[model samples]
Target: MYETFDDTLLSRLNEPVPRYTSYPTAPVWESTTPEVYERHLSQIAKRSNPLSLYVHIPFCKTMCLFCGCSVILNRRPENEETYVNYLCKEIELVSAAIGGRAPICQLHFGGGTPTKLTQDQLERIFFKIVSAFPLDAHAEIAMEIDPRTVVEDEGAKLKLLKKLGFTRVSFGVQDTNAWVQEAIKRRQSLEVTQKTFRLAQSLEFQGINLDLIYGLPFQTVATFRETVHAILEMRPDRIALFSYAKIPWLKPHQKAIKEETLPSTHEKFGMYLAARKLLLGAGYVAIGMDHFALPGDELVEAFKAKTLRRNFQGYTVLPADDLIGLGITSIGSVGDGYFQNVKELSTYYQLLDEGKLATFRGKILSPDDLLRQWVIQRLMCDFAVDKAQFQLKFGTSFDGYFHQERERLKPLIDLGLVSVDPVSVRATALGILFIRNISACFDRYFHKKEGPRQFSKAI
Candidate 1:
């Protein structure tokens, strides 16, 4: 079983670390032209496995002060209509670059608030996706929604979304406490969130995920415990409890929040521990970092079968590797490399209007990178890795290559957060609490560089 770190150890380990969404995180990406992405896609089209698609909808009615995602303050219908049309064009451009329709096994729509679009706007985009790609018969279609946006006509909108092929939906219910919500500027009542969830359940959605943030302005262990109890009462199929990254430095809007109002590190840790105990008591299996799923959930099954995967969207049950990102500030992977679209809407539109792909910069995976990525993903997903499997895949002695890194991890191993031997590296029960620190052991970038903060809190 995993164990907790002492206060001294916890304080020392709480620092910035990459989420490891990708091997070479976005910060390392360099300028990548449309032609390079085009060539990469051409190679990907020859692969046997199908692809995954990620559509970014960077629009929101009201900005949340704690958000770090690229987004526009959109409330106008005409602006949404215009963005929807461009999304279609971007899809077409990507479809062409791949030379034709490719098998897509997973499709996800992520954003500031994907539900902000009108039913008509959503329909138009769904039509484009239907026409552009050949989706596998059992493909996973997921979307992220804001609870405040669709309270007007819940059943009609959800029913329409179901008809359009959405099997999964996540509602952003960061906190149910009114003061906590007010502090973040995303003030949705608990009743509204329950209504949306109940509607989705009645429509028979395959899965429901409730998004919760633990570390935020004015959150206490007792209050968050109440929030967890309410969430458990709803019984969402999955839960993503994230630590709020107060990155006002990167996302300037976050500056509006008073730093003093945020919970202290010790208090925030208590919230996490309490929430985990309650969820486990409610019969949810913790899946990777910041995620939990009930038994029989695909995510839990994927973990058991060792088929789980990590991507820009966090943990995914689908094992599809090639992702085609469509829309502004979107990112995708092709032929072992990652490419990103421009973040600004004006630039994104300018490129797409000229019949160009909106790739900004990218990086191809190096052999060493691939090996390290596999090791990292394995540890992150499975909490352990077999040395034999490592050797079989990479044709190198795992210990021989990562000897220095293995040595560097001795402190964590001694602290009882992780156990490493000649055969395997495993995170104990409480060790999983500091899994990011364990995984960071294999990240070469952090070791190679000095004095730079490009990531969020490890907790």
Candidate 2:
């Protein structure tokens, strides 16, 4: 792919675009209340759709300069306990709203660091959730962890996670280079990362994922290759090779990272190509835009079968019809709407204290919104859209409906990144690298002239 890369294409495609984790991304969700959220929950109850749960554990001991997530830097154990209690309260409220006993097909705990919680804290939260919603027979339970958090305990925490029915664990190892790690303010040594990986391996976790970031400060092509090679040696069941999104204005802590220290656009492209080549050579299958998994992994199987799905939680093999997000700043997609909890801890507590569900913002998908969502999701996950299927499902001619979008895609088509025909619209192998750019074509809201850029570049 790089053999064809040039300054012209970079200049043309390297524009800010939404990741499309969801259509009408979070930035545009309207002000919403718990009452409206409850109405959405009632819709789910009426449909009796199985649901997935995403619990946000937003506490961290320290802030990493490269982080973009909503997190609280609190060391008080009491704070965590309080959050857990409120989280459980929110869960119970949701359960009652949905008429209780909704089956869960997938459950994931993401951070700040889910493992940052003490074992007791984790257990209490975990039991509260499972007790409210029974887990489906083949449900997938997973959590994200900072390796440094578990390395000191000699896998004690890992064992407890397994005991609590967590089938998967994702270890966050942004980079292996000491200099790069230092620049990012995340100093997990290669040795510590490996030890923690081996610990999870020994526990016989059903699926182990390793996350890496490219285009970070102090990263070079050679250094990033070394990082990729080191992670490949661990042979994680799944790998998420993510591009670093630099939005210092949105995440103030990112200011700690000097822009000059970051890799240039061209160098970042080179780093991705190098890492991707290595992963492919290792026989890992690319699942979606940024995820790779070994042949037997469920994600790979899903990708191959074209049953893969995406959401705020990224790609998943066991996605339920609805996703319920718990905890502050967490976002949920239920029925035809998306909703999120308040971002502040004080506000979160206040809402739950008032016996409310804590929903602060949300979007109700309109008919047009649903159509665009389908188109964007297919382009992102399947890298193509079957025009016939679209017509059959949406009761509209894909080309006729998206005539303007097709006109918008002409540039990508001419660049050999996309192709459209009577039957389908597809991305070439080269276009997968710019999937976000391709998906953005169908996004009616992605206007460069619309205030400040809310997303990162697509290169």
Query: What is the lDDT, from 0 to 100, of the residue 241 in candidate 1?
Result: 94
Model 1 TM-score on a 0 to 1 scale = 0.97
Q: Native-vs-model 1 lDDT?
A: 0.87
Off by over 4 Å in 2: 448-452
lDDT of 2 by residue, 1-459 (tens): 567788777867889888889988777778988999998888778665578999999999999899988888989999999999999899899888987645898999998998999999999999998888888877899999999999998989999999988899999999999999889999899999999999999989899999999999989999999999999999999999999988887899999999899888889999999999999999999878999999988888888777788999899877587999999999999989999999999999999999999999999999999999988888888999999999999999998899999889998999899999999999999998999999988988774344346787886
Models 1 onward score TM values of 0.97, 0.98
Which candidate has the top score in lDDT? 2
The segments of candidate 1 whose C-alpha lies over 4 angstroms from its true place after superposition are 1-5
**Deviation in angstroms for 281 in model 1?**
0.5
